[model samples]
Structure formats: structure tokens, C-alpha cells
Target: MKSKSIGLSPKSFYYGYDSKKDLKHLVRLVLILVFIALLTGMIGIWVVYRSAHERHLDMLRAFANTQGDVLDAYMLLDEVKSGRVHGDTPHEHNLDNVKELLLKQESFLETGQLLLAYEDTSTGKYILIGTGHMPSGQHSVLVVENTRELTPSMRLALEGKEGVLEGQDLHGAPVVTAYLPISKHNAGLVVMLNQSEFYAPYHRARLITLGIGVVFVVFGTWVIWSAEQKNLRQVREREQLIRLSFENSAIGKALVAPDGSWLRANKSLVNILGYTEDELLRMDFQSITYPEDLEADLDHVQAMLKGEINVYHMDKRYFHKSGDIIWSHLSVSLVRDEQGEPKFFISQIQDITERKRVEFENQRLHERLMDQLSLRRQQLDTASGALEGFAYSVSHDLRAPLRAMSGFSQALQEEYGDKLDDTASDYIRRIHRASTNMAELIDSILRLSRTSFGELNVVSLDITAMSKRVVENCRVVEPDYPVEVRVAPGLKGQGDLRLIGSVLDNLIGNAWKYTHGVENPLIEVGQEHVTLSEQSDDSVLAFYVRDNGVGFDMAYSNKLFRPFQRIHSDREFEGSGVGLASAQTIINRHGGQIWAQGQTGKGATFYFTLNHTQFDSEKNSTS
Candidate 1:
């Protein structure tokens, strides 16, 4: 015998239920889980790659140190035989012997090279002689030209720095390189390993890991979808027994008459309304419905009676027996008899009071956060206005007094030179110098303020040409030394021409000033295209001004870009101590960074990048 249901049809039951909403929520959960899995896999791959890269770097460093020691032995042997050894310019026969020995050692590596180089002081360039593996079991010696741009490893090595780095080789192939500066010989040794070959296994592993993660996600999603489909089918089957199961259902269920009186109420409904089933049946639904929601519920009931809608579901509030409001997901549907006459209504209710409470609390927190954000913006605006006012005062009110002081002191020194004692004349001269220095300090401060606060006027700039002009200006300032300057060709960037020019002037000018007493003073302005990382092909161009002159202590390198902070005293080097600070500000405004590297008595290299927002991109330290 087929069991007859009470009032609701299968179509209305399905329409009134939230099955589709539940399925959508489950789908979102699956997607979130998949995303988390993929993210975790990517993080694992990155961790493994970082570990492998670090290991290889350490190995390369150890190998380079060994080779450096070997070269030291060879130089000692040569010194013993020839009574003299010049590493910067080794004897041809001895260099050949050393190359042969190094080449023999390189047989252990599949894609490795041994490089020997010395700085050609005449041209401020490196003269590279390398031995690489050849197919015929013989070594090839290639002398790279002086015109080729020096790699970071080469530059650091020539400046007596020893480290391992990843960069391009002479032939422009990406390579992991190890460099050692032979202090006694004043030369450098470098070893090259193909970067792609070294990291090929790790790259392959990462791809395999991602493939596995994707497969797992797809399979897991399919399993979850299959389970959900099965559950949906079971739910549809259970709809046939709804009338028999109504009293035992977990959700609040009720049968209401056309006149809005509760014909029957389940235990869940009684519990939700905090009322007895008999009490609920005696009262009409409108009596217990919250006043604010009663009108909408009536409108929905009217629409259902008029055959305009079969079912309706909404979030509504109900007045409980205790006079407290109850939030619920309410679904109501019209029931019809066989004669096309209206019957009772079937209502399903689920408690959502906690969810509503959380939603309202989140809204309040969001409003508070927005208010705090507005307050911060207002404070920032006020601070900026004050800074502007301070800048204006310094520019206008401070300069006149400083100028008068300098002018009067100079006048006293010049007009009263014969009448004044020697001590008085010296005192006047000191006063004049102090006032002039203070004026210069003020100018530097104003420049920094402008650089920090001014708007950008970005344009394509010919950096090579700009560098050449700056270097020429440096030459014009001190023509007696005849320092060799090399500016790389065809360099380009986007920046304010005036501001970038100032950066170059400060850097190159500093180089020129510090290299005054150095023999064979060399200043090379060049660019290096540095890869962001092994996993990405993106690269940034870094411009550097290299000088063979006096350098500062690395311990105080942090003070280099602080206003009025000088690593070297005025007696050793003269500077306003704000040039680098202003340069930093301008670079930061252009979305870039500036840094320096140097060792005392060796030289300094000032490196800066433009239009690069991420400043922590890896770069090798200069010696």
C-alpha cells in the first residue's frame, strides 16, 4: 500500500528546503581546502628549494676556498723558483702551469670553469683568463675582453672580496659563481657552475610536487561531490515520509489552518517558541510573530493563498513565550487538496539566533575599525601640514641670519687684517667658515625635505649619458689626478631627470673625492641586471659607481644614509652627511633603494636601483 502524505507536494517540499544553499556552502568549503593544500605544497617546495640553494652555495664556497689555497701554493712555488711572485701580473709560464693544475682539478665537475683575473689599472677593467671543460679532454683558455661589463662576483673579487654569487658569465649564461681575492698577488680567482644544471633536480621536484597536489585536490573534490550527491538523493527519498516523520523531525515543523491557527505543532516548535504544543495550537501564528516581521509573513501567506507563490523562505524574528526575540530561517509553503481547495500550511523553522548575534557583532566591529581608520588619516594630514610649515620656515627665516653672519665675519677678517692680531684674524676666519658650513647644512636639509615631500615627475632617462656627464663634472673638479672613468653604454631608466642626476653626482662625486690620494685612481660606472630569484625570471637593473680609493669601516655602514651622521671624520673626508640621506629619500620616492659596500683602504661601490618597489631583493655585498 502506498502511504499518503498530508498537505505538501514533492515540488513544494524541494523548493522550500535549502538544499541548493547547503550544496553551495559545501562547494565553497571544498574550494577553500583545495586552496590550502596547494598553498602548503607551494610552501614546501619553496622550503626545499631554499635549503638546496643554501647547501649548494656552501659547497661552492668550500670548493672556491680550496682552489684559492691551491693557487696560493702555486704562487709560493713560483716565488721559490723565480725569487719573486706578482699575482696581479704573474709570469706567463708560471700562469700557464697554474692554469694546467686548476684545469686538472676541474675535471671532477661536469659544467665548471676556473677563472683567473687581474684588474688592468690602465683602463679600470678586468682581464679575464679562463679554462673550461672541452669535449676532447683538453682544456680551453679564453681571454675575455676588458670591454665586457664586470659581473658582481668579478667586481667584488677584484676589490679583495671573497664570496659565492649567482650571476651571468662572460658569455651571458646564467651561472653560480665563487670568487676569491688573492691578497698577496693582488689578483682574483673565480669558479663558475651552470645555474640551470645545478638547480634542475629541484625544479623538477617542484613540478612533480605541484602535479601531485593538483591530482589530490581534484580527486578529493570528486569524492566530496559524490558523497554530497548521494546525500541529496537520500534527502529526496526521505521527503516521501515527511508526514510520518513530522513529529520526530529536528527542525521545528507545524501544520497551520487557512485562518492562521496552528492545527498541530511538533516538539521542536514548542521548544523553539518556549511554549507547550497545546498553548501554541490555541494561539494564531500572527500573535507570536514579531510585530516587525508579521506584515511580511502575512504578505507571503496572502501570495501563497492567491496561487502567486508555492513556497517562500526568509530570515524572520519570532516573539518567544518568555518575551525574547528568536531569529530563525523560516520556510512556509501552501498545501492544496485534490479538489483545488486551499488546505493547511506546512512551516519549517531552524534556530539561527547565534548566527544573527555574531553577524551584528561583526558589523559593530567593522564600524569601529572604519572610525579608527578615519582618525588615523586625519592625524596624518595634520602632521603633513606641520612638516610643510616647518620646511617653509627653515627656507625663509633661517637663511638671512646665516648669510649676514658669514658676510660680517668675512668683512672683519678682510678690512681689519693689519689692525687685528693674528689670533683675532684666525678667530674671524673660523667664524666665517662656521657660518658658511651652517648655510651649506641648511641647503642640504632643504634638499632632503624637497626630495622627501615633492611630487614625482617620471620620464624615460638615458642613464648612461647622465652618468657620463656626472663623471665629467667630477673630472672637471679635480683634473690633476687623471682618474680613469668608464661609463657603460645604452643604460636606461624611468625617473625625474634632475633628481636622478643629483643622485649620480653625489655618488660619483664622493668616489672622486675619496680616490684623490690613490695611485691609478679608477672610477667605473656600470649596471648589473640581477635576477629576482631562481624561481622567477624577473630581473632588476642595479647601477653602481665603483672606485679604487679610500673606503669606510663596514661596522658603521648603517650610518651612511643618516643625516649629519658620518662614518669618517671631517679631517679624513669632507661631506655634508646629507647627500646619501637625500639620495635614499629620492630613491624611495621612485620606488627603489640605495646602498653601499666598502672596506677601509680598498674602495667603495654605491649601488642603487630605480622603480623597484621591493628593496629586499638579493644583491652581493661589495668589498
Candidate 2:
């Protein structure tokens, strides 16, 4: 038997369909939806109305209680003024005040009023003592009806049953009112709000809900009918979209037969291979694939046929129609028939020639940079060794000569004193001092160099204790100097213990040395709060050593940390000038900073910061 394509023609597909039955079903569904929508809207409207009404009643209850309290207050005041409790006749002035207060409150509401009434025992009727709508200066009058004819709210209040309810007011207008009895004053208070004003919002909500329900019904019904008619067209459009996507794709796409022959190719594939679709269909993938990549491609194909894999992806090279090799990222998937027989392959290819070229160039550049870095590291090692040798020479070889010179000068001065004049003795003393200074200078240079070169041994340090120890050492060296030193407690930091101690020695010792001659000398060691940046909440702790001493000039403060630089004369204060410089280097090695602030004879402060420690400013009470 010959095989036949089982497909429906457009004319038969359209003409043989029963749309009327489907339309009837859709109409029924839309009607059910509209009914549900309307029912929901009605329930929503009712909910809003009840909620608004209850809220109004709550407000009315509050107002009635407040008015009752005010009336009781006035009655109590009147009783006190009359020299009795619950006087039979209340003060008339107090009544007038109550009426004025009620009138003022009435102005705040729209269609709202307050009524104060007391029952006449003999007539069994209520007498209005005050009303918000009354004339300003009018006296009490019989404005309300008898107890039987009074409004429900007022009757309830007279009976001492306090509550809020909807009823008619004295003017026969519908209203919501709160009623409370002031038993002490033998009167009742009624606060009324017009029903129309209170319910306006609820009515607007109902109307809006109804309008929305109607619009929803009409729009929903139209949408259901239109969607039903467009279903067939959408299916057709989806097929067209798939076709257009395959043709307009930037990457190459092809369908190949199980025999490795091209069954179909898209325009992008034709462009990539520099061939027409008809020309590609006559060839096989193996003919265009580079020889180096052909074996791998064939392996993947064979494995796919044997059910080892459903898809394979790889970067491979292919020979274009122009005989140029191109790098491509290729993805292939097998499509099988329902009976598990191999049908064809779907291949997607992306050209990656430029990407491969850039990757190759970067690989070469990386290798070159690595070589240069190795050479530079070797050179730096050689220089560092040379520097170490030079420091050894300065510390040992040069220092020995200075010591000899100083010893010879002292011996000459002591042994030849009788033969020498005053000028010669002065010359010998100067030579001894110079030799001592030079030796000290050399030591300071070595200390400064070591600060920058050593590996940091960071550990938790009690900076407060260190500062105190430095201060105690100063007192031991100069026992007569009576200076007050205060080190703040809880000053903790993280840094190399020996290096940080050295920094403290320089800073605190300098403070002690400079405060020698000043009366009532004082030194303070504390941490200051320093924020890293305005935009960041992170902060660093900076410890400061402050002193009351002969401070240096602010203009020359920049020279304080330079090697051998001095802002003061040697006769006034002695220093090698490398202490602050060494302190700065140690701080920098630990990722911190150091600076000084001073004036011309008032005081000076040296501040230094350390990494990885945050201080609480509240604990800092030193200065």
C-alpha cells in the first residue's frame, strides 16, 4: 500500500467545525463569571457600609462620654462654689459656661449638635438646659417634647442607659447619636451627627463597586469571545516564528541526515561556509570538517547512534568554502523516531576564530610578564643584601672609631688639664661631645632602617600598660622631675610588641624630656577616635601622647620627623631627631599613620594609629 499524508485542508478545517456549540458554552461561562463578580461586589459594598457605620458609632460614644464628664465637672464646681455637694440649686453662671462650651463645639461639625437636658419631676418632661443650635444668650427653655415623645437616644439617656444608636433628632431629621447620663448633675447629654453626612462615603463606595462590576462583565465577555477566535491564528504564528528564528539566527544551523548528508541548511550556515544551501545539501559534514577534528566528530556521531549520548558539544575547526580554516563551537543533538530508529541530527555552530586568536595572544603575554617578574625579584634580593651589609658596617666598624675618639678626647682633657688654657679645655670638651653625638646619630640611623625592614609580628598589646612602663622608666632616669602622667585604661591594640613598645618609648619619653623645666608638668596618653572616611562607617583607633611643655613652632612642625632635624636648640632640649621618623616607619609597616601637632611653648601631642583595632571613645579620659 502507498503511504498517504494525513493532513486537513484549510477549507475542510474551517467549514466542518461546529462554532455555534462552542460559542454557547463560552457564553454560559461568561454569564457565570459575571454573576460571581456582581455577587462579590455586593458583599464588598455591604462590608464597607457596616464598617463605616460602626466607626461612626465609636466616635459618637467618645463624644457623649466627654460631654457627660464636662457637665459633671461644672456641676461639681458649682456645688463647691455654693459650699455644698450636689446643691439643690446649681449656680446659674456655671450653666451659662456649659452652654457657651457646647456652642463652641457645635461649630466644629457639619450637621452635628449637642443637647443638655434635665427632667422636670412634676411635669414628667425634659427641660433643655443647653443646645448647640440655641441662640447665644438665650436661657434654658422647653425645647424637647415630653419623655414619651422624646427621641429614642434621649429617652435612653434619661433612663440612664448609655449607648450609641441611629434615630431621629428633635428636628425629626435622621441622625446617629450617642447618649450618656450625668447622674451627679441630674441631667442627660446627647451628641447627634447627621446620618446623610456620615453615610456619604459608604454610598460612594457602593456606586463605585457596581460600576466596576459592570465594566468587568463587559470586558471579560469580549475577551473570552475574541480569544476563542484567535486561537487558530496563534498556532499558525508560532510555526512562522520558529521558521524565522532559524533563518535569521546569527549562528549557523543545519539538519543532517543519518548518513551524514546535509538535508537542510539556514542562510547563516550558508554564509559561514561560503556556500549556497543547494550546494551544502549535496555535501557531507565530513567533507568540510578539518581532518584533525573529523575523527572526534565521527566518534561522537557513532556514540550517539548507539545511545551513549543524546547530544554533544565541542570546539572544532572546519574548512570554509574558500579553503581557510575557521574555529567553531559546534553543538549536535540526535533526533530519533518513535520506534527508536535514528532520524537526523540538529547542528548549531558558532564561529570563534577571533576569540581563539585573542586567547592565544594573552597566553603569550602572560608568559612574558612572568619572566620579567622573576628577573625583577632577583635584582631586589641583591640590593637588599647589599643594604644589610652596609648597615652592619655602620653599626660596628664606624661606631668603634667614634668610641675611640671620645675616649682619647676625655683622657687628654683629664691628664693635661694643668698645661691647657681655658680655650683648649673648651676645645677638648667640644670634641668629646661631637664624637658622642656622631655615635648616637649612627645608632639612630640603624634603628630607623630596622623599623622599615623587619617582618611584622602582629599580636594583641596592652598599649596603656606599655605607656605606663615607659613613663616609669622616665621617672627612674630623672627622679627629681615631678610630672603627672595619666595613661588611659582599656587602651588595647594589635601590632608587633617590640616595635609598638619602641614607638611608645620615643613618644612618651619625648614628652617627659620636654616637660623638664615647666612647672606642674603633665602628660596624657589616650586613644582618639579617627574615622577612615566620611562615606564609610569604619574607623581606626589612634593613640596620642600629649604634654604640657616647651612645644615647637607650628611652622617647623614638618621637620620634626626628619632624620637629624631639630626645631629646638641642643642646649634647651637634646634629641637625635630620628625617633619620630622611626615611629612613623613602624606605624606605616603596620598599615597605620603618625603625626604631630604643637604650638610655641604651650604643649605638643603626637598621634599614631594602628590597623585592626577599634577603640571605644568613652574609655578615653586621659586628655
The numbered model that scores best in TM-score is 2
TM-score versus the correct structure, for each prediction: 0.48, 0.52
Mind sharing the TM-score for model 1? 0.48
Error of 1 at 410 (Å): 2.6
Instruction: Give me the candidate number with maximum lDDT.
Output: 1
Q: What is the C-alpha lDDT of each candidate?
A: 0.79, 0.78
Candidate 2: the clashing residue pairs are none
Report each candidate's C-alpha RMSD, comma-separated, in the order given.
57.5, 37.6
How many angstroms is residue 174 displaced in model 2 relative to the true structure, after the best TM-score fit? 99
For model 2, the local distance difference test gives 0.78
lDDT for each residue of candidate 1 in 1-623, tens digit (9 for 90 to 100): 11113444423443345676778888998999898988888888889788988988888888888878988888689767886565545554555566666666544477777777765555565556566743224465544455345567876887899888998876678999999887765667877888887788887887888788889999999998889888877776676466448877899998887767777777888989998877886778889888999889999999998999999998899989999999999999877877877777889998899999999899988889989988987887777677877877887789889888888888877787789998998888888888888888887888887777766889998989999998777667766677888888987888999999999988988888888899998998988865556998766668888999998888878889899998777887888889999999888889887888899999998888886543234332231
